[model samples]
Target: MSLRTLSRNEVANHNTPEDCWCIIDHCAYDLTGFLDAHPGGCVVLAQSAGKDVTVDFFNLHRAEVLNKYRPQLIVGVLQGEKEEIIPTNLQDLSSVPYAEPLWLRARFCSPYYTQGHRKFQKAVRRFFAENVNPEAREKELDGTYISQKLLNKLAETNILAMRLGPGEHLYSRRLLGGVINGREFDYFHDLILTQEFSRSHTRGFQDGLMGGVCISLTAVKQWLRDDDLRERVMEEVLSGRKKMCLAISEAFAGSDVNGLRTIAQKTPDGQCYIVTGTKKWITNGMFSDYFVTACRTDKGISVLLIPRGHGVETKTIRTAYSTSAGTAYVEFSNVRVPMSHLLGEEDQGAKVIMSNFNHERFVMVCSTARWCIAVVEECLKWCNQRISFKKKLIEQPVLRQKLARMISLAESIQAWLESITLQMCKMDYEEQGKYLSGPIALLKAYSTTSATEVSSIATNIFGGRGLTETGMGRVIEMFNRTNKFDAILGGTEEILADLGVRQVMKVFPKSVL
Candidate 1:
């Protein structure tokens, strides 16, 4: 199809009863009565009116634009012609099937180390330029970003559809069942798993918009197996869909299995557990479908899949990272969950919770490494382009030294992660069950700390502009949020550090000296 291009002002003035327009892409669609439900404020639709926006829509808004509105609500023409631009030398070859493909793609694409690699580096650069812009890639959450076909399929499966609009609570609920639904799974997986697709689909904002509901939901489904309860929870997730979060944090305890205070007292009728306590700094706490919470039981600490409604109160908490899946201070007032909703067994909640963290930490480390790498690359690109003292910043000896240090740090962490992942891939469930705790803690602590340092150095390199939310500012924001997240989620840095020390001691008690 031929994609038609039009200017913002030109399109704004050409609005007709039969035409609808997308300001950022400058694509038009027919939306005569669609203005009423637009979550981004009608001005967005009115601004684009009847125009085409293929020029540079990303440059017009801040990176948070996608996070502020639902992209699906903004309709556009599918019949427009595709414009051909000069293709870069870099390309994504990972999707191509090969019988004896070289490990080069995986190596270069490794979030930690991509430098000195030709094809992979080039692909990475091209992917960033095309997808990472604020307007096109980063924006407030909007419903328009979701695929209708997938939504329809979900609806057909008895799943209620809640169109996620931007600025709502992120990561409030756990999504279940959709993984088996081919279309829905592929659509959602593309957003969470790939950087290239994420940028094009504005998934960061969606992640921020949905909070971590998708991942949390996936985890819950994996951990819980009751067909009826799972369906009920899935309905809740699909209902509000946009503003939900999972809470794993507790006051006075983190990453320490024995330190939890929230108690689940068993009742006579089918063993009900009354939970009461405060869970601090929970992601998506401000708004969440329900919490897959862990609490102490008579047998041991157990996991309770609790839905949010009555008896659960939350307050939004401010932090170093402003954009979030919606972090919150949560308090459970005698909340109760039936024995049927309990994940695994009593006191065995630790196992369930611990198991989730292993995979979660791995994903976080990969993403954190990717963020750091992206920051370094962005800083380098900026330094090369910006002239300082009659020479480029890249020409400065000190800058080169800093860049080298950052690269080295990233590479070291990357290597450790890769080695561990390889090890994990080979281990059986029994072996993994025993071997994962220490490594997971160590990796989380190491990667997060490294990300913090890399981001700080990258910001210093950028000078004052780095502090603002523009230019390479999004990288700074991502680093800040992700770094803090690394310390809090999965396991806190302090907790992990202590665990690492204890694990070593357990292995060699006599070598304490």
Candidate 2:
């Protein structure tokens, strides 16, 4: 990595296209050989020849781009100069103010987080940074499915199991090579994992990364009557042998669960059912091997575990985000499901379906809040790196006010998220269902709504770059486009806000007359 020091006067002599050189991040690059191969072509290089182009370079490219061409293009350092912006180390916590949650900062403390949580966070962050992030960016852009090889790595590391949160599944396992015992895993660990995945900022790939298994398998474990069936499915999914998705939302019904049109008919023999229904906007549906489905029965709505086979069809449905999410329109045409595969009871499926909502929304809140904060980080970085009107964006009083609000929003979201997570850690399923549901809903609603605000302000700050899909404002662009997914994914902000108020209303105090 060593390079010889060269003076600006020395570098100025190489101005010709035949021997082009430029300074970026205090390092002198020999762009002569790279000119023809540059993605932006020789024109920009010719314009930048023999000049210190650090600001121009970053304004047009991410730091990683320099790293990509470092060995070949970087020839020397500018004499007596050093870089202020170092290439990012994925394993390192960001130094940008409020880029990370308060608990993660050096001096700030949260009663909710512990040393075990810290250790687990570091290990998990490093693991994903090394194993998953490169492919995440690639798959997110190329709109391809996540690979089995990486899925297996997730399984092998117990990352897949951890994503399912604390359960018997994690009891006997070692997490991230035993950085923390599985028995010791708590909601904080789960929260950390969720936030780390979101921090990667590959929104579509986030869902494709076993998101199905996280939301669907819990129902199988909780409601399926046949112990062997539940165990088999869990093993398959946790091992990445079979993928699963919760297929409940239909074209006609989403948040309104009862309005679902999918129907399951009991056979005369009473041994099986013929499920006939179409599910729209099913995440990971295109690649799922098993679907934890919802269907109307003779009595009421029932949850069913239907495998992908004859009569089961999935067609990709493009959303605002990448197709890497495997979002699909699913049709279950007279698919036969064993009576034993019924989750909970035939008429009591609503209980099973609703039971998953609290936890599912909780996880979504974790992701949503972290995603918003990550956008704040990107904005903060942009404010520092991006120069406008002869000064950095951060120096503008009005822009700084916008940032103050952003940082405040980010901090508030994380604080609320951690508070809810702490409550979750202390509460069991029934307790959470009774006491925490309303607050969690409110939090999810608030987080997504706040994200909406953050994304807009960020775009305005980035101006034209924020609208561009690639380059300096790509993160802002991606966030601006996909922030609505969180608002809609768990439940729309309106639905959740209503649910939150309604839940509290159930116990509202009667006015004194």
Candidate 3:
């Protein structure tokens, strides 16, 4: 059915409290009923009545707000007008400068991204924009875990397996409608997926959505002694029938993995380990079915797969981001984990734990870099549109400099990230732990530091809206509040810097001055 067409005069004629109409992006909205329920209030709607409110509406409201209320509010299109330039679909990439990476921009070419990468990127972006973004926004605010329905969709599409990064794990699985063959997947594809997933822009909820499976399942796939046991665990978690988290941090230990006090004593019959420990700040723990946990044993600190069962308990731990992450304080009270659950050598679990860390931090870098650019894009849009003191924010010299700095930081970090990602593609896991750890560490440290700076500059650009939880500047506010998680979660900025330097020092040559 054709939508009714209204002329400027027709829209103007309804300009009253009882019959309010306004034009936004060449579309007429019958907001007569919505006025009372408008978040900004009826006065604002009444004032906007009978006018083309495209500028005013976009200045204060995000495109998403329009998407949410459009069905009920929209009554017709402005006669003889077209909205060809308006960007309404969240699934499409932004035209705003620096909104996307260089490779994704028109007329820009990269040696890294291939045809498959482009196709896969589009598919993944559409999937999140359509399937995940709605739920993430709701869950981020409500402090709920990822819904099973979404997880099932993700699993059915093999997205969960892809998040574990390219390997045998991806073998035989048709990924995202077979846009990319699993056998040919590489770290670049992994990078693409991680960045796309983070683009959901819901920080804590991003973590809540099967993030644990990404970090924990790799350890199970690599170090579990029994192949059957390992495959079983992987199938369960990746299929979304079961959930898992990496349990390494405790009250007494975080960066210092050796300081863990969690104890695991062997049973008399050698059937299981009686594990007793409390793991703090575990992502996705609140709803996890398996915990790839670190514990102290007869020999030394070791890693084990502790299933959630009798004597296992989880308590929520609220953090700077939403509790949607399921960050929890977990207690294992004499939990009986079978001998078959041991990962790697009993005492050499540090090796297994260390194996996952490089990739974990690499994933963190990918997320942080993408998120920084997303914020830069947000600031760019706001500066271009938001007027202050008789001019758009972009017209000011200081704000321009801030935008310049934000852009430089974001671009440099992404470049470094891509460099490291390519090296990861070339190296095996052991080789990566040996060669790329320091560079990745340095990259993550710099990435997070850049992110912090970007967020700070964005807040200044957005002013009061940067502090708001809704409206045009909400993206800026979200990044400001949660960008620090990158610096803290994988490893502290200071600790990573030190590690990066230490890695360099390991091969340093002695010199006489």
Q: In candidate 1, what are the lDDT values of residues 270-290, reduced to their tens digit?
A: 577788877877766665667
| lDDT per residue as tens, model 2, 1-513 | 678999998888889899999988888889998889987789989988899898898766778888988898888988888877677788999888888888898888888878988998899899988889979999999999999999999999989998878877888987888899988899999899999998778899999998988899988888999999889888888888889999999999898998989999999999999999899999999999999999999878999999999999999999999999999999999999999999998889989988798889888988878877888888888888787888888899999999999888878888898898889899988898889889999999999889999999999988998998888788899999998998998788999899889998899878842
Candidate 2 regions off by >4 Å? 511-513
* Candidate 1 accuracy as TM-score: 0.63
Model 1 error, position 3 (Å): 20
Candidates in descending lDDT order = 3, 2, 1
| Pick by TM-score: 1 or 2, better one | 2
Give TM-scores for every candidate, taking all chains together and pairing residue i with residue i. 0.63, 0.97, 0.95
Residue lDDT tens for model 3, 268-352: 9999999998999999999999999999998888899999999999999999899999999999999999999999998898889
Ranking by TM-score: 2, 3, 1
lDDT of 2 at 34: 85
lDDT of 2: 0.89
lDDT of each: 0.57, 0.89, 0.90
| Cand. 2 TM to true fold | 0.97
**What does each candidate score in C-alpha RMSD?**
11.7, 1.5, 2.0
